[model samples]
Target chain A: MIIIAILIGCIVGALIGINAPVIPYTYSTFLAIAVVAALDSVFGGITSVLKKNFDLTIFISGFFCNSILSIALTYLGQKLNLDIYLAALVVFVGRMFTNLTIIRRYYIEKWTSKIEKDDKELQQ
Target chain B: MKIKIKKEKLVMSITIGIACFALMLVMFMQFNMVKQTDITGIETMRESELRLELSSWNEKYNELNTIYQETVGKSEEYKNERESYEKTYELLSKELEQLNKALGKTDVEGEGIVIQLTDKAGTQLSEDVKVKRITEEDLLIIVNQLFAAGAEAISINGHRVISTTSIFSIGEEFLKVNGERIVEPYVINAIGNPDYLKSTVSGKGGHVDALKELGHETSVDINKNIKIEKYEKELHTKYID
Candidate 1:
């Protein structure tokens, strides 16, 4: 059921995205910020799940709040003639990388331990 | 315990799906934007591309020029329509004013004369001679004479004399003009040429002289300004279709 739901949601979202109006390039900066923030939140959610400390409320709230705050900052930056969105982009991307590394290291260690146990049983 | 775990997993999956959906949507939108608009510096363009850009801009300018001219024409048409509407408004207002004047619907003033008629004093007459008090018939006769003398407007005892006016005796003690009881002194204001009005009312062989002969108090004053009030009642016509 869960896999089917995700597949449906993704397909529907893709369809809607294809039909969606193309935003002007000037305001595309805000979209970029939002996309980066959401991606960072997703990676963070996975890392928390691996560490057994996941909270759905915290994950969703972080996702939305980060996006909104980043957009606001981008607007202020434009008024000040500065590229402040770039700074936000860097932070979100950096956090995403750290989360990815944590997830990768966790799965790799789990797999290696499982393989060693299986080899000992085989020898016995 | 297994059911609870399944429910938790279902919740988590839905949340994850929503997040995935959002990511896909945003990414696709960005993809579309990137595909549609080429973000390149103007100085890096080739000569041929620059000429094509210039031609497209000129075409856009021509389209915009036609639109601007069409808007200007529409504005001029609206201005003319407003002017004509204003002219019609002015004409209707003037017509309303004139109709009101002719219908005795408004107070009027001009060079005219005031005729005041009072009952004969008891002391001035002998005991054998009976005083003929001023009656409504005498008023009607005098009003007719004033209108005959080209009086534009007239009033008796402050009651406007319109086309529907009535002058008659109610009882032995009171006379009615325009349905209101008028007493001893009747003030008649007539708006017209003062000399003509005076000559018609108080002139020799006029109704005023006849009243004086009947021992009634009569006086006519030529005035430069005499105001006659409008009729108090609303004029209605049910018979006219």
Candidate 2:
């Protein structure tokens, strides 16, 4: 049921976004940074869920807050003639890598242990 | 117990679905925007490249401005020169017309007199048979008298008299003025003061009265407007320097 809901939401979102009007080139920087922030939050949410410490409130808040904060930073950076979005990108991408490592380890450990248990059961 | 667990799982799924929905929406929107934007457009140019492009355009604009100013100045100069040229042409043309008038090369008009001399010796009664018919010398004397009275222009029998004019006879048969044959009655036109011209050619000692006593019919008329034609023959000196 959860997978079906997620699939439906993604498909609907994709359809709506495809039909949406294209934004100006100047604002594309903000959108790009916001996407990175949202992707980072998603990775973090999945990592916490695997760790058995998932909070729906934290996930939702992180998703929206990160996107907004990054966009604001990009605007401020333009005013200051600074590349503040670069800092945001680096931070988000680093966290995403960490989350990915955690997800990868968890899956590998579960698979290896399952194979060992099957071998022991067959011998018994 | 089963209902509570189902409710909790449903809520979690719904929140996750909402989060994913938001993410996909923004991601796809950015994708479309970036896809439509031309990567090679000025918007995407680096700062240094934009600066360079702007500077070159400014240089080109300044060059064109200089050229435009120079072209305008040149046109103004040409306009002034053309105006002066037209003025000189007009002055020269007026002077040439005046010179032609003075040279007797153009027709003249003024208040003057007309004289007609009819040689009636052939039909005259009791006239001396030896009184020769009107001669070139008689006509020449009358012309000389009209000139002395300030006649500005003169013509005889349609022949204009210029500085080079000659009055003579080809024989006793015909008279020649400006080398063209003329017969009686000789009609002479002289442009001048009308009363002055008539009085000079007539009266007691005048050539007309002298010719009248010899049986030639002579009459002088004062005219308000008399036109003397221009000299047609070209005047060129062969020996005079």
Highest lDDT, which number?
2
C-alpha displacement of B164 in model 2, angstroms? 8.5
Model 1, span A1-124: residue lDDT tens: 7678679778877887887899776677788889899889989988998999989889988988898999999999888878788899999999999999999999999999999999999999
List TM-score (chain A only) for every prediction: 0.94, 0.96
Q: Per-residue lDDT tens digits of candidate 2, residues A93-114?
A: 9999999999999999999999
DockQ-derived CAPRI band for the predicted complex in model 2? medium
The alpha-carbon deviation from the true structure for residue B231 of candidate 2, after best TM-score superposition, in angstroms, is: 6.9
User: What's the lDDT for residue B27 in model 1?
Assistant: 71
Prediction 2: B-chain TM-score = 0.63
Candidate 2: clashing pairs of residues: none
Predictions in order: lDDT: 0.86, 0.88
Pull out the clashing pairs in model 1.
none
Residue lDDT tens for model 1, B1-241: 9999999988878886887788779877977776667757543564357779999999999999999999999999999999999999999988998888777999988889999888874535776877777778888999999999999889998999999999999777788877888887889999998888889888786898888888887888988888889998899899999
Worst 10 residues of 2 chain A by lDDT: A23-32
TM-score of chain B in each prediction: 0.71, 0.63
